[model samples]
Target chain A: MSEHKNHISTYKSQILVLLTLIMLTVLTVVITSVHLGPFNTAAAMLIASVKAAIVLLYFMHLKFDEKIYRFMVTLVLAIYAVVIIITFFDYLYR
Target chain B: MTGNTSTHRLPSYLEYQGKYTGILGWILSTDHKRIALLYLYSQLFFFLAGLVMGIFMKLELIAPGQQIMGPQAYNALFTVHGLTMIFLFIIPGLAASFGNFMIPIMIGAKDVAFPKLNLFSWYLFIAGAVIILIGIFSGDGPPDTGWTFYAPYSLKTNTNVVLSVFGAFVLGFSSILTGLNFIVTIHRMRAPGMGFFRMPLFIWSLYGTAWIQLLATPVVGITFLMVVADRMLDIGFFDPAKGGDPVLYQHLFWIYSHPAVYIMILPAMGAITEIIVTFSRRTVFGYKAIAMSSLAIAFVGYLVWGHHMFTSGMSETARLVFSFLTFLVAIPSAIKVFNWTATMYKGSISLEPPFWWAMAFIFIFMIGGLTGLILGSVSTDVHVHDTVFVVAHFHYIVFGGAGIAFFAALHYWYPKMFGKMYSKKIANWGLIGLFVGFNTTYMPMFFLGFMGMPRRYYDYLPQFADLNLLSTVGSWIMAASLIVVIVNLLRARKGTPEEMDDPWGGRTLEWKIESPPSLENFEEIPVIDSEPYELKSK
Candidate 1:
């Protein structure tokens, strides 16, 4: 009810976002075909994250929505990051 | 007129029994209080089922070799026991039952934000339980893998791992929905003047627990599905022969499970805080510290899952880091315990059943927590990793902390929840018997584990037999005590002669409402005008 008017994104914005997501997906597939070895996963994740940010901001409307929603997403990502790091701590070190 | 009104009150939640009719009214009801009672009835059944399994297991242990059940049967019983207790009883224990009942009332809401979703969660829980039961009958054999259902054997065994694990996964969904409902309810539903800090410590703890239930459960849910995938499909997710590491399964399982421990205990801790402050006639000491500590515990709990895997062939550095994190998580827990003690100091106190249980909680919880240090250390855990010590330690914390605290909440809120009063004298005797019985059953296991008796074994050497017998005897006493407690409460279900609001002189918003609460939980939403837990000295 705290309104800036639940901003509905325009169709142009939606189409542009969709195109960008498709381009990123193709780019990730092309990149993975080449062995960047250690950087392969890192690069893919980075690009995929950009795609996620675009989707979250535009499609999910976290961009125009309240700041709290954005903070929650970041916090969730942080928890998953921690889980991955701890798991790899055992695998890589061992 | 007062007598007539009292007698003709239309049976607050229990007897009026909503719109539907008979059992349909209960299972189909959207009333949060009715849904809560539905949970109570169902959970009590599962609780007794788990208890019976314990008695049977203890009987089998009374004399070394199999007495009443076969070795395979023993495995099934204990496995079912763990599943029933963890999933069916404790995980949803306080939160689903008392949380559903109290949260909306405490927050001055009509009902939970999503009442239909709450009913759906209960139905999901029952459906999950039924699936697990079906797994027992339909499987090549009963699920013999312990509740952990650790990989390799879990996948290798013919016992219905897929269906049972599916059951557990379904239960996790139920837990997540309840958690989601509580979080939204708390955020959106508080009375006009109530701020976050102005809310009771119980609400803060429930807030912490909801986050855990929402976030942590998904990992276990995914893990179980991976198990199902590996079992049904040719997925080599956990089978080493199929090119997967079983350790990964463990890492995934404990990642959720370790935090899930708090999912059970944090709410119990909150209830303890509420009861202690109410009866002691004191404002809670370190209220912010206790509130923040719940969050700290939930946050830190996730990091220490590796401690459970220290001896699982994890790297030395991983072990060391997890060991450190394990110890780190304990600090917030210790802070809450200390704050509870400080709140009771130099305060006028009433020794109610809840208080008695809370005191015993601190004692048993201390034993459980201190022993956790032994398990937390990289070197010490290697010695007692799968021994009876771990069992005793777990039972102490889970059963003592959550289980006894459950009784504390039951006794503290009894008159309010049911609008009736039971015999406090009988409650005390039951408490004494339960306390003595509980410690007797589990204390020897610390020695048995130290003496090198491995857990999940159907038989033991002659040396461990005597202690096992003593533990079995303790089980009997505990069982008798539980009957007395349950019977006493059941008998008091009839409406009481006395008026019941603020019976414990509680300062929480729930205390301001009528006993048994209205269908909407409030005639009109109350305005919170003061801080939670303020009590006048008697």
Candidate 2:
């Protein structure tokens, strides 16, 4: 029940995060054009994951929030990862 | 305690008038108890609707030659029945009604963390139900793709699948919000000294159910939207001709639905635990075991969705892995079942109506759980896939496990909820009919299914006619008993409220309050200092 003080990002940090997101977006499109063979989907998903993390940490303020929030998010993502890996069992074998 | 003393007693939630009067007061009130009642009445309405549809489907199969309706009508009947029962009735059934009513009081809090959001969730539930009904009546015909809405046929069917799918998507939102609200309430609103371990087992089950509801529902929500898009916008999500893999659709669908089974039953197990502990007048035997088992079930439940797709063209490796996971999931459930039985081992047991319902739940759940193993194994499941055996197995779990547990909760909490005591004798009689008739109806389906009778058919072969006829008669008996149960409860509302606050001598925090608890639940918030179910004899 301890309410942590709200954290506001400085303008410079916000601008930097936005630029990084833009660069990742450009890199995603450029990488898709390069055709990494079996790694194409993997490369795109990895970039998307990084961008999502950045947005969550800065815009969603997970970095400033209590550690429990971050732990919960990681738990959810881990479960999702397991589900996806289980789904790939079919594709990989078939 | 005397600081806020008044000459008159506080008004119970039912008697309190608010900004609006009459039904408006009920619908608009942010009271958790009123919202729970809203869910209770609405669930009953939908349950009866689904019950009638089931009887009609049974009647159609009475003689095995289209006794009541043709194939198409039969299809529509079962589809709507499945939609209504699964989405509108049982999925949100116990948790929304009893959870909303009891959670705050049980935790020694005034209300949930988000009371307004709780009421809004109910609105979303009704809105979703209305949209599903619109899909039924206003369409070219009711969606005949079955409740599963399997692809290819779902896409090709002339019936309105989009509206129904969209309706389910909306319902998913309601489910998610309810889950989110419950999670936050449990995390933030416990009374002082009420640690997670000290909280009631019912709350623990709800915590597990909320996590499942929040995490698993969105997968199905997005899947439903994709189905709608496939039907309306021709996006080819599940359409094979358009290069979409129908099996992928099944994957996404079962990813949520398999966990959805836990969502339906975990609260049920929790309620039974409370009832058993109260009636037995003993501390629960394996408190942490039961609590941890609930989370275990929720976690393991996610990995077993592939069992449903065993025959749906999944690879051998995936099928084996899923089958193994399915069997693995049963260990935690068995842990819960064992814990409940051991709790009553050497205690002062009261054979109350609620206890009877709980006993029936265990008996039926054992059958359902054992048979689930049969269905979980890929070999046996391939034999009974889409057969009546699968139907019988799930009915025992969902209907017998969750549905009967709902009745048990109603009976256990009736005096505390409505401030009136129904006749225990009549309730037991109703249970007799329900137990006997429910078994009669579904038990034969297992034999019929093992004998190769498929489900959702308007008519069956001559060999299946006799058992089908018996099952139809069982439905009639069940319907009659439901009438008795409903009438008995309704009649009791006219009687005087019980003088004792704790009619059953229960030990939970809810029993410490006045019957039909006052608005805001507590005049002075209680500071918890003991265990949830510590009996005096102990």
| Per-candidate clashes, comma-separated | 0, 0
DockQ of each: 0.83, 0.90
Question: What C-alpha lDDT does candidate 2 achieve relative to the native structure?
Answer: 0.91
Q: Candidate 1's C-alpha lDDT?
A: 0.88
Task: Report the C-alpha lDDT of model 1 over B1-538, residue by residue, as the tens digit.
Answer: 0010122343567666556899898888999999998998898899999999999999999987778988899999899999999999999988999999999888888899999999999999999999999998895877999999998889889898899999999999999999999999999888888799887889899999999999999999999999999988969999778879999999999999999999999999999999889888889999999999999998999899998887788888899989999999889999999999999999899887878978988898999999999999988999999999999999999998898888888888888888889888999999999999999999999999999999998899999988999999999999999999989889888545578867787777777667877677665677666677755412
Top lDDT: which candidate number?
Answer: 2
Off-target runs (Cα >4 Å) in candidate 2 are A33-39, B1-8
What is candidate 2's CA lDDT for residue B148?
A: 88
**Candidate 1: residue B494 lDDT (0-100):** 59
Cα miss at B30, model 1 (Å)? 0.8
Clashing pairs in 1: none
Model 2 reaches what TM-score against the true structure?
Answer: 0.97
Question: What is candidate 1's TM-score against the reference?
Answer: 0.96
lDDT of 2 by residue, A1-94 (tens): 6867989899999999999999999999999889667568778888998999999999999999999999999899889989988887787787
